[model samples]
Target: MTTTFGATSTTDEVLQGVDLSGKRVLVTGVSAGLGVETARTLAAHGAKVVGAARDLAKAERATSEARAGAANGGSLELIELDLASLKSVRACADALVADGRPFDVVIANAGVMRTPFGHTEDGFETQFGTNHLGHFVFVNRIASLIAPGGRLVNVSSAGHRYSDVDLDDPNFERTPYEPMVSYGRSKTANILFAVEFDRRHKSRGVRATALHPGGIPTELARHMEPGEIERMLEQINAQAATEGQPPFQWKTVSQGSATSVWAAFVGQADEVGGRYCENCHVSSVTDGTIGIISEGVRRYALDPEHAKALWAKSEEMVGERF
Candidate 1:
């Protein structure tokens, strides 16, 4: 029987009856928000979860609550990871590889939201570099360690509707940089990366998927100025008006994490892989337009050709091949 979980479902609810004993899972951005809840839920189900973050001390503190709540044989470990730095990504990947532990699931759940225009240490646009490229390099470097039947879940966003990747000017070198636009491009890249990664790796029994973890008031918005936040709320209300729907509601962290946990553990790879999920199910494809409160994914975000192109571009930018 198919169990349908909804947007309000919590991680524990979505994972009901699921057994994760002996499962080795990796979750990024576990310092707070949805990441913390995701790791806690997985660990509470007997999964040995490694939580990766930019700050080990912060992660330890943030996840201490999770460790206290662990059930069965569940456990949490912290590892240092700074997605904006290529050197850090490489080192993290190398450390995981050296550990010689195969992972059943890898959730790239950490990300930066709309921020002032800036560049990563590698000189790429900050959002794109940290959100997409960092995970791209990390995943590719550690791809071999994913056990057969393993899953990769990229935590994307509905904000992808705001813009698609600008292949030629990804760094905003020629075009003017808009913070939300850059964020949209990066989120779109997250879905596209999953698409291509699934296409290429499915033959090896590894599947990939992406999802929008719903709108939650998390530290992800810490960088947004008050004016930007107001502007975003105005856009959301305007979009809601057009859709004839209620204004967007903020999801609790548990609700925001349900889809990622569900995608990681509850479904068949062949069925869920390469799809974009929201509200705990595969999302429909919609016209690519800017609508912050829209329900479906944009067509361009799921384009296989764009996925392949992004893969190539990512390889070039990272100075490596997957």
Candidate 2:
């Protein structure tokens, strides 16, 4: 029988009865929102959690909040990591490696959303660069230290359903860039990256998963205009109210993070790899539709040929290898 979890399930619900003592977890974007919630829940259950954030100060604040909520939150550490730059990624990884700690779970939870056109330190499109390639490079740097039987959870988004990866001109080199398109492209890459990484690394006891955290009114969308946010909420509310079905909707932060927590510790997910999930199950892929189809992965996202090509191109672009 296939079991399904929902957007309303909290991390505590997903982690109930799970023992994570002695396990080491690294969570990015842990300063606030879903990332903080994910970290707090994991640590409360006994996992040694290192909360990495772009801002150390904010991370410290998050740590205090997490500690207040966790029975075993002493393990939470705030590490500096800026996903917008390779240099920053390397520095963070180097420090972690220096600590000589092995991580049992690496949650790529940090990401940027729809924002005006911008570029990274390497001059790539901002949303695509930080949300995808930045994490890509950092994952490679830390792959060796990831526990052999560890899980790598890449927090992707359903916005991926908005568009597929653009190979011809990913960086808007030849074409004009659109904010939403760039966000969608990056989310798509997050899925494909997991597919390829799991394919290559599962043999070594490393598995990767990509998942949509469900729609939540997270700070990631802070860059968008107020009207844009309202419009989005209106659309989701309208869709849900009209459908009477589950709203196909956005979840609260705890609810949004439940699936990722489940994926990290669920017994059923232990050997599962290279799949995209939402609402705590393998997400259904619907063609030209906003709703899920109920089974199988996205064709373009899992295209082995494209995965390999993207891997190669990414390596060349970052001058790094896994």
Best by TM-score: 1
For candidate 1, lDDT tens digit of each residue in 164-281? 9999889999999899899999999999999999998999899999999998999999988878777878888887887788988889999999999989998667778999999988
Show model 1 residue runs off by greater than 4 Å: none
Residue pairs that clash (backbone atoms under 3 angstroms), model 1:
none
Clash numbers, per candidate: 0, 1
Tens digit of per-residue lDDT, candidate 2, span 296-318: 34567767788888888788778
For candidate 2, the per-residue lDDT at 154 reads 92
CA lDDT for candidate 1: 0.92
